[model samples]
Target: MSIANQIIKQFPDLLIKKDEPLSKYTYTKTGGQADIFIMPRTVSEAQAVVAFAASEAIALTILGNGSNLIVKDGGIRGIVMHLDLLHTIRREDTCIIAGSGAKLIEVSRFALSESLSGLEFACGIPGSIGGALYMNAGAYGGEISDVLNSATVLTRTGELLHLERDQLAAKYRHSTISEKDLIVLEAEFALTLTERQPIETKMAELTEARESKQPLEYPSCGSVFKRPPGHFAGKLIQDSGLQGKQIGGVQVSLKHAGFMVNVGGGTATDYLHLIEYVQQTVKEKFDVELETEVKIIGEDA
Candidate 1:
């Protein structure tokens, strides 16, 4: 029997898809396929899948909302796990507890509905709660680390753990999740009680700022490079005259140099080549290396 069949047989209740095209999931709308894709609805189901992958010596890839990620044309091997069905959001006193699959934007809106403050900056972030925490996602002047109270995570070995904010070691676009190969299941945020009017105003202002500056009309992985010390990635790219530069179907966003958009029919190969070209051009002109903030994974086609 094939591994996909084996997976279904092992977990009869779980939804499983074979040779699924991952482009349907990624925000950029560009990717190859997954050998076996599974979305576990319950925590126990997730743990079981992790255990199965480990015991069977099959590779496992954890994919969140895929807002800031790139999967190459060669696709991912073995099991690809997504947590979309686990999305749930609720308020607990002065805090909001959200499942990993919950979008940051939704969580922010939830906070607004409850008259809770502190998630205003995430009102426009496209990633899921887990993806936001993994990258310490930030916008304007706020970051996930600022309001995060705790998180429930599962190690690669399928051991569940609850961790405090300080234990996460979160920094600019980084956290211990990647280094430790941990998968976030849920996150809790401590918020302040505020008037609904102020929250609405803040969200509206931020929404306007983001919409005006970003290339939201096209498919793109938000923010290609990390901010270097004392310098902005967008400014550097813009100064390097990289705006609207095209390679294959992907092009450097004219609205924002930090983003590479799939104009139409863009592929993963196009995106990768454009990234390399931008890095090279920026390095040659400014003597600064543009390190990628977006997670690039899977194999080359």
Candidate 2:
């Protein structure tokens, strides 16, 4: 039997598949394939998967929403776990306990439904609760650091842990919580009750800003680089005259220099080559280096 067959046999209840096209799973709509793709419905199911992968020494990676990631055209080896099946949300007195797979926008809407005010910045982030917390994702001058309470995680060895916000080393586009195979299963946030009008206005303003500033009409992994202090990365790239540049099917967005968009049917190689080109051009024109914000994973195409 194949390794994928073995995996399904071992984890009977998991939604398992073989040779699944990764394009269906990613925001970029590009990638080769996944050897083993599994979506576990319950926490116990997720834990069981981790244990099985560890026992077999399989290469395992968990996926939340794929808003800020790029998978290579070469399919990933081993198991690719998805937490979307674990989506659940519960409201506490002044806090929300959210499942990792729950959409960030869903959480924000829930907060609004309760007349809670603190999640306004997350109203437009197109990712799961886990992905947002993983990168300390923020917008409109607010960050996860403001409302994060704690996380329930599963370690590499399949042990369960509860860690506080500071313990995760939450910083810009990173967290130490990911150093191991620690998967975020759940998170809690503290919020406050407020009137409806101001909250609605803030959400509308942010939505408009994102639509106007980002290349939302195309396929992309969102911002390509982390902000380098004192200057905007997009302005620098535009000033270097790299806007609308193309590599294979990838093109620097004329709409937003910060965005490296897949104009149509672009490959991971195209996107990568374009990134390198922009980086090289920016370095030659200015002394500053651009650091990538989106996490690029899987093998080279």
Candidate 3:
């Protein structure tokens, strides 16, 4: 039997779909499909799927909230797992324990409700806890590395491991999790007890700033390029006169040059081509190399 067939046989009760359209899940609303899409509700179920894939030598891709990712037009092979059902949050004194699939916005709101202060910067981030930790997500001068105390992860071989903050080696849109291909199961954040009003005020301020600056109305993978050393990606793109540039249905967000928005019915090929155009244009104009911050995966159509 095929790997997909084996997965179904092993987990008959699990939510599994074949040739699932990844476009429906990604923020860009583009991409082809996944050979097998599985939504695992429990950590044990997730582990089992991982172990099965490892045993079969099948590719396993963790699809987080799809905030900072772009799936290719040809779609992903093997098993694509989404942990949305794992969304849960709990508080222990000044610490917040969030499941990997918990949305960052919800986590930040929970912190505000509990009068915890440290996650205010994540209020506007549109990714899940696992995705955030994977990329060391940051905004408004705060980063995941600043507050993450520890995390529970499933190794590539399906063994559960607990790693401390120091062990994560999180820095500037990177973490050890990506290097080791570990799947985050849960994260513990060390926050401070604070007044509710102040936390709400900060969240509001950050949200307002994000709304004013980002093109949130469109379908985008958030910031496309990382900030080059001593230079902002948006500023560089804007300075290169690449704002409002379009390739197929994808356009450089007029609101923020850092974003490449899917105006309508865009393809991954369009997105990738536009990225290359912008990088070449920016390099020619400013002589600075632009690096992508968004994670592009899967085969090309």
Candidate 4:
């Protein structure tokens, strides 16, 4: 029997789908499909799936909230696991324990409700805790590395490990998780006790700033390019006169040059073309190399 068949037979209670359209799961609303998609509700179920894939030598992909990601037109092979059902948040005095699948926004709100101040910066980030940890996600002068105390992860070989902040080596939208190919199951963040009103005030200010600066109305993968050294990606793109540039249904957002928005029925190919065009244009004009912040995955069409 095939790996997919074996998975179904062994874990009949697990939700599994074949040839699932990945566009429905991504932020840009593009991509083809996944050979197998599994949604694991509990940590035990997630571990079992990981162990099965490891034993079978099948390719495994971990998907968080699908923000800051682009799936290719040809789709993903092997097993794609989504941990959306694992969303959970609990407070332990000054620290917050959040499941990998919990939305960062929700976690921030939970902190706010508990009079915690450290996570206010993440209130506007549109990703789950796991995804944020994977990329060391940051905004408005704050980053995940600032508060992350430790993470619980499962190795590719099915070994569960607890990694401290130093073990993560998170920096500038990069983390050791990708290099190690480990799956973050949960995270603990150290926070400070503060006045709820001030935390709420800061969150409000950040949310307003994001709303005013970002093209949130369109389907996009957030900022497409990372800040290049001393230069800002948006400023460089805007200076290069690439704003509002379009290829197929994808366009360099007029509202914010840093974003590549899906104007309509866009494809991953279109998104890639636009990215290349912008990169080439910016390099030719400013002589600075713009690196992508978005994580592109799966096979090409």
True lDDT of residue 111, candidate 3: 95
Cα error, candidate 2, residue 161 (Å) = 0.5
| Model 3: lDDT of residue 34 | 99
Q: lDDT rank, highest first?
A: 3, 1, 4, 2
Q: What is the lDDT of candidate 3?
A: 0.95
Q: What TM-score quantifies how close candidate 1 is to the native fold?
A: 0.99
Q: By lDDT, is 2 or 3 better?
A: 3
Each candidate structure's TM-score, on Cα atoms with residue i matched to residue i, is 0.99, 0.97, 0.99, 0.99
Which stretches of candidate 2 lie above 4 Å from their native place? none
**RMSD for each model, in Å, please?**
0.7, 1.2, 0.7, 0.8
Prediction 4 TM-score vs. true: 0.99
Candidate 4 ranges with C-alpha deviation above 4 Å: none
Residue 190 of model 3, lDDT score:
100
lDDT of 1 by residue, 1-301 (tens): 9999999999999999999999999999989899999999999999999988988999999999999999999899999999988899999999999999999999999999999999999999999999998999999999999999999999988899999988888889888876687999999999999899999999999999999999999999999999988899999999999999998899999999999999998999999999999899989999889999999999898
- Residues 146-210, candidate 3: write the lDDT tens digits: 99999999998899999998899988999999888899999999999978999999999999999
Worst ten in a row by lDDT for model 2 = 172-181
lDDT of 2 by residue, 1-301 (tens): 8889898888877799888888887788888888899999999999899988898899998888988888898979999999998899889998999999999999998988888889999998888988887788887788877898888999877899999867877677667665554788999998998897888888889999999888899999888888888778999999999999998888999999999888888998888888999999988998789999887888876
- Pairs in clash, predicted candidate 4: none
- Local distance difference test scores for all models: 0.94, 0.87, 0.95, 0.94
How good is model 3 by TM-score? 0.99
The predicted structure with the larger lDDT, 3 or 4, is 3
